[model samples]
Target: MSTDTPPPLPRQPAAEAARATEPASPGIAGVDDTGVPAGGGDAAEVGRGFFRALFDLSFRTFITRRLAAVFYVVGLMAIGIAFVVYLVTGIVEGVGALWFNPGAGISLIVATVILVPLFAFLAVIALRFVIEAVVALIAIAENTERTAANTRR
Candidate 1:
């Protein structure tokens, strides 16, 4: 027998070995959260399914569904405050008028002209929020249905 040990078998390239032996990443392969490989499914389909499930679980659905109600409450509170302010100011102006305070009348007119439109603009914004919220709610519902269907497979 030869004194020197035989040279080790030629090593395979790391990249080639890794490619041959390693399974694809979870989403890349058909593997789901359970780590069981999905049976011979297209990788793209698997990826799409994974993301759809993720989206369904996200808060997008919850915020969308509740947004309209939240905005409506906030808008109501703002408008109520505006009305109360207007009423209080009117009362103050009336009392000041009895005392012939010109400054109070001028200030009251300025506030009425400027602040009413500002509040109206805010109301319009709230309405827009309601619309957007409704759209989001619909999207969430549709997504939930799709996800459910996918999971059944």
Candidate 2:
């Protein structure tokens, strides 16, 4: 037998693939929170399937990809809550000290007003990238599976 590698599949832009897929309806039954189809499995199927996959010893199916969107949203919300808490603490502390040291009080107030949002924005951007990276990896895995399936045919 000849020892030769097959050529790689051609990369197509998603816009081109969009033409092949069915038009997206607002509410798809088997869709994940990320709005992606959950492998065409409905709620009961997902529940049972996820449970089975969760216990899968061979580790074929992935649960992280399905839950990544939820984790991302939760992380963002946590940062937002922390931002509010920090802002409130700064405001209270700064205002409380206004009577003793006007300059320092004003400084604290200004820093709180400017820095709280700045830091939160930075955290959000960072979280977004981290989540995106994870999602990207999941997508790569999925694409690899698709390619493998096609190659078999």
Candidate 3:
């Protein structure tokens, strides 16, 4: 029997793909301190610009509103994993058996299993709220900066 290769998969038109990949015009790109596009700046300059933009009031608020739920879920997952590690360590070290008497061990484990997740959920919720508020404050500062610039103009 002769071996045969499969036909090539469909592909995007080269001209269309090239246009999509081209960088934005300088007018649309953010200017670094040196008056060049941020993409052309040195690593330190770019880093500073990124942080500045991140902390800008409007941007910060936008990010916080859009990402708070995602961050909260991630925090909860992290705390849940931490609780698992703690439980494993306790069991491995015989802390449960040593600290609790008779049926108390089972009860303690049950309580821990339930309470750990509840605490983690509550903590994440609080953290999200705090982060959102901080971001909002930063956004307000950014808005003030813009207003000042516009007034000056």
Write model 3 residue lDDT over 1-153, tens digit each, in one string: 666988686588888888888877633357443222346658898677667767897653234433556776787678778878866754544445646574666666666667766776777778777866766775577568668988994
TM-score of each: 0.36, 0.69, 0.47
lDDT of 1 by residue, 1-153 (tens): 677887777589788998888776634355454323454668888667556655786644333332455666776777778767776776577567746777777677667667766776777676777767676666667567768988995
The TM-score obtained by model 1 is: 0.36
For candidate 2, report its TM-score: 0.69
lDDT of each: 0.64, 0.84, 0.64
Model 3 / residue 93 / CA error / Å? 7.6
Task: Return the clash pairs for model 1, or none.
Answer: none
Which of the two, 1 or 3, has more TM-score? 3
* Position 144, candidate 3: lDDT: 84
- Give the candidate order by descending TM-score: 2, 3, 1
Model 2, 2-30: lDDT tens digits are 76999676588777887668556545466
lDDT for model 2, on a 0 to 1 scale? 0.84
Candidate with the greatest lDDT versus the true structure: 2
